[model samples]
Structure formats: C-alpha cells, structure tokens
Target: MIPKINGLGRSFAGVAAYCLHDAPTPDERSPETSERVAWTDTRNLATIRAERAARLMAATAKAAPDLKRLAGGSRGGRKLAKPVLHYSLSWARDETPDRREMSRAVDGSLEALGLDGHEALVVAHEDTRHPHVHVVANRVDPETGKAATLGNSKLRLSRWAEGYEREQGRIRCEERVKNNERRRAGQELVRTPWERPRHWARVRRERMVPGRARRARGPRDEERVDMEAWRRVEAEAWETVADGRWRSLRHLETRAREEWVELHRRQEEMRQRLDRESRTVLGRLRIWRTERSLRELAGAIRGRQDLVEGWREDLDGYHRDERAELGKAHGERAREIERGWHKFYRSRLVEAERRAWAVRETMKERQETRERERGPSIIIPIPRPRQPRGPERGGGGFER
Candidate 1:
C-alpha cells in the first residue's frame, strides 16, 4: 500500500467536491465516474463542506473574542493558511482490499496523521487497475477548532503503513522498512529525487499547472494541446523552410538508440542472474531430493512407508513454493522491463518534440529576419480626379 498526502488546500468545499464528484470544475462534472463515499463523518458532502467552512470561518474571524480557539493559536497568532488535507491510499494493482479493509486503512491513516475524529470524507475509486481511496479531511478540529499538527507527517504515515503491512502478512515495500530502520538508528532517511519537496515541486511545475497534480500523469481533454494550432505552426515553419533542407534530428535518434541498447543490456544481465539463481536452486533441490529418496528407500525397507510418504509430500510442497516464488519474481522483472521501455520511449518522444519545436522557432525567426532586412516594398500613390465636385450631391459646391 502507498499513501500519499497531497497538498494542504484552503477550501474544504473544493477538496470535498473533488473527492465526491471526481470533477475539478463544474463543467467537467461526471456523476457516473464519481466514486462512492465509503465513509463520512457528516450527513452529506455539501453539508460537511458548509459546516467545516463555517467552523473555520468562526474560528478565524477577526471579531471573535477568544482568539485561542483559532487554528495555530499557539504559533504566534498566525491563522492556518491551509486546513484541508487531501490524502490518498493506493494498493498494488493486483491487490484489492475489500471495503472493510479500505475503511480500516483510511481510519488508521487519519489517526496516524493526528486527524482522527476530524471531519473527513472517504471516497473509494475503482476506475483504475489499482484500488485506491481519496481522503478529504478538514485539519481544523470541529470541537476544539485547532488545526492538527503536521510535524513529521510523512514519517508517521510510513511507520503506520509498515505496521499495517506486517499485520496483513505482506511486506511488499522493502524501502519503507529500511527507512524506518534508519530513523531508529538516527541516520538520515534516504529519499528519492521525486520524494524531495523541492524536486517534486519543480517537476510538478514543469509537467502540470498549479493545483492540477491529480491530473498531471494523464492530462485532461481540455488540458491537452490544440492539434490545429500545432499543425498551423508546423505548416508555417515548413513553408518558410521549403528549400528541401531540414535540420537533422540524428542526435536525438542516436541518443534514443543508445539508451534502448543500454536498457536491453541491463535486462539481459538481470535475466542471466535469474537463470543462474534458478539453476543453483534447482541443483540444491535435486541433491536434497536424491538424499531424501535414498532415506525413503531405506525406511520403506524397514516397513516405514508412512514416514517416507510424509517426507516426499513435504519435499514436493517445498519445491512447489520455491518454483512459485521464482516464477513470480520472473514475471515482476518482465513487467518492470516493459514499464522501463515505455517510459524511455515516452521521454524520448517528448524530447524530440521539444527539439522539433526549437528548430521551427529558429526557422521562423530566420524567415522574419530575412524579410525585415529586405525592407518594405515602396508604394506609389496615384491621385484620382475628384468626382467633379459634389454640388449635384450633398456638397456645398466645388472647392475654390
């Protein structure tokens, strides 16, 4: 299970609307695609949003007598900038915990983040291959009106998830376990590039618009590029450079090829390692089986056929589990390779498109510069005879 605590937003309505309706904007509303509300502290989404908004407003109101009830009251009297917590818990693609389990996970996450008993909405979405739920919680406690502390929230969630996974008998994330160990030993936790806040923010800025992180992985229809505009730009650039001379994109092609080759080499190395491990395991298993068979034969000669059968059964089960584990590992590796290739090609395509755009801009600029240097064509104005005075029309007679 992977838990992601998204941005702290300011609007409870906005976050609630997003989770309940699955629509960022009113125009994009699709009730059919909206996930069902699995659990909520309030009666309905609208009511919850309104109640939370009211509570927050009252708590933060300038006219309010008791400023101590406001969020962040102890932190030098600063109001909470963002009080809405948008979080998500997603399971592996093949693992779909039922509604009860999902509810428990959501509850545990909220408690871990110090938002237990806070007004929250849990929506379970089944639109994707993986089972995930979106949690929109108000950080301000309705009763105390104090915003929940967010200190070490990420680490807290990670620890909670580790424990939850252990209880569930599945420890799929070794990195989480290692990080927890490091934390206990007073060592700095190792984080990936995307895990760093600054790097994540930069990537989000480059790849998506502000406040649109949810749709960054897959752009919405309206967020997509206008093909007609792109076509016009391409055509104009091509027309300006119609001399049959084109900028070579061989560098991009070569880089892509080299990367692909490197990927293949890595995959081959992994495959070879897997094969060697498989052979070693099989050899050991075979030797053990031979020894077991010899013992079984001796036992059978001593009229201990039942003991021999039990040993054979145990051997068979052990071999079956081992083979199954190896098969699962091989399949996972294959999937990883496939995903790597997909990402590699997609990134190369993006880079090529960017390069092509730069070339087009350069060509357009050159064409414009050439036109400017040629100077404007002179226009000689030809004088036309006046219409013989407009006396017969509406004029005051012919001009002197």
Candidate 2:
C-alpha cells in the first residue's frame, strides 16, 4: 500500500520546482514525503494566479502502463495544464489505495479536506517508485479571489484513508474487479492454486476504468450504488490491510513457482529415459547369455560326436586283427596234424623191414657162427613234441 497526502497551493511553476528541488529526490520520496501542490482553474484565473507553467512541468511524466489508468493531475508525479484546478497528491506504492478504491478515495479525500469544487482536476502519478500527485490551484477562486488554504488536508486525507480500511463490509471494488478477471485464467491453467483464481480476477476488475457513473453498470431500478459512500468505508479498511498484508514482498513467489515446475519436468524426463535405457541393456544381456549357452552346448555335442567315431574305428580294427589270427591258427593246426600222421606211418614200415632183415641175417649168421654175437645192441627212440589234446590249439602265435 502506497501512502498518499494532499495539499493546496498557488504557484504551478513554484510547486513544480519545489517538488523537484526542495523535496527529496524522487529516489528519496517516501511515506515521509511532505510537499506542496496547487488546485486552480486557469480558464477563469490569470497566469500567475493558477501557476499553469509549474503545473504543466510537474505532470509531464506518464504513469506505467501496467498500473491502473491515472486520475488526478499526474501519472506518478507529473504536472499537466487543463482548464480546471487540479488536486495532486504524492502517493507511495506502499501507501496508495487498492485499485478498486483509489479514485473514489482520492476524490473523497478532496471533499474530506474541504478542497472540492472550484473547477477541479485530480492527477494521479505513478512514474516513480513512490508515486505522488500535484494539485494546482488558482489564487483567484471561482467564486472569489480569496485563496484557499490547504487547511489540514494532509491530516484529513490520512484519516479518511485510514477509515476506509477499518470500516469495510463487503469486498473492496478493486478486489472484486481483480478476482473476476483472474479467476478464469487460473482455472484454465490448472497449475495455479484454486484460491488464487478468484483473487487475481478481483485485481483485474480493480484495474478496469471508473467512469463518471462510478460503477460501470446500474441497479435494475435505475438507482445507483453510491461509490463515493463506498469509498469512505473502504478507506478505513485499507489502513489495516495496507500495513499488514500489502507490505513489501519478501521475495517474488511467481518466479519460484515457475522454476519448481521446470525442475520437476526435467526430473521426470530423466527418470523415464533411465528406465528405458535400463530395459534395453537388460534385454541385450539376456540375449547374449542365451547365445553363449547355446554355443557351449553345440561345442559339447561336437566333442562327443568325435569321441564316439574314434572309438568305433578302434573297435573295427581290433575285430579284424582277431579274425586274421584265428584263420592262421586253423591253417597251422591242419598242417601239423598231417605231418604227424606221415611220420607215424614211416616209422612203422622201417620197423617191419628191420625184423625181416634180422631173420635173414640169423640164417646166414648161424652158419658164420654167431660172429655177430659181439655186435653192439643198437636201439634209437625218435624225438617228437606233444600235440594239443583238445580242439583249442596254439599256433606260432605272433607270426600269424
């Protein structure tokens, strides 16, 4: 909430110079700001009386676009010349009324200070960090040249502003204005908190124009809600809220929220990507393991096959050798049997011839008188190997 105060003075140029020079630099203006302004109608007054030159210089600066449309003499603290006497006030962002009630409160301040009428203008300024207004007045009154004193305008303005805050009943017009406009946008986003939508809309409404009719629409019966009366109540309530909730922001919450959202999105994306990579790696590993197992199995089968074939070849060679040995044995056995029979027959015949010779010799020898009686008795036995008795026989073993 910006603090604001009003004043009445005679010189536009003098006041402009004072606000610029005598007052603290715009950098230094604060709730402590105490400066003079004028309220006058140049149309009915002389140049010196209205001080149009000074008023014009002070109101030249424009208000920021984001702020509500400026009413009164200056945007933030500018000086412009019009036919009517203008009321100007210096308002701090920390002390100004909520947008919903600013204009009415400013106007109400004028009346409360007994500075109303007299062909008036109200310039509200916002160019500086702490915005303020300048009220340029004609020394010559619209009714008479009798100069109007500022007459406790500051105290009255402050009191009225304070009262508006404490006397609140319904929501402030500005709050309602802001909440209505913001409600839909926040709802659409879904990311915004539910409570914020209505509050933002209320701020939007407060920024809307306040016309000659005050409220944009009228009652059904054509009776108008007295916005001026409403302003009084709001002013009192403003004093309480202004110092408490509307204090300078500790930090910018909006930026923090955006940063959180972006960070969360990045984290989720990384998690998903990691999960996919893990699955792919796992699948590849499974395939590799399976292939390795199959290759090992195939190698084992090939080794077994080779071993079996080698063993079969060895068995066939062994059987062939055994059959050859058997055949040689049979041939040798048949030869041996035949030779034995021949030898037996030859021996028997020799023995029979010996007997016949001996008989003949005996006849002859008898005549020779036993001359052979001294002949040595000679008998020789033939040497022969024993034959195999059974069907099983041993041949010249290894040679066969």
Q: Whose TM-score is greatest here?
A: 1
Report model 1's TM-score to 2 decimal places.
0.42
How far does residue 373 in candidate 2 sit from its true spot (Å)?
99
Model 1 misplacement above 4 A: 23-76, 191-400
Question: How high is the lDDT of residue 299 in model 1?
Answer: 48
State residue 330's C-alpha deviation in candidate 1, in Å: 46
lDDT of each: 0.59, 0.41
lDDT tens string, model 2, 1-400?
A: 2234323443455444444333455576433433333222222223433335445423321212112232222223233223223445444445545443555555565567554543333343444666555444332234332334553444455555555554654223354334434432332222345443233322333221112112222222212333343334334433432332222111213433354455445545644543443345453344335446554344334444453344345545654565455435543543443344335434433433444445555666696676666576668988898876433465533442
User: Candidate 1 has which clashing residue pairs, if any?
Assistant: none
Q: Per-candidate RMSD vs. true structure?
A: 20.1, 60.1
lDDT of model 2 at position 316: 52
Model 1 scores a C-alpha lDDT of: 0.59
- Candidate 2, lDDT over the whole model: 0.41
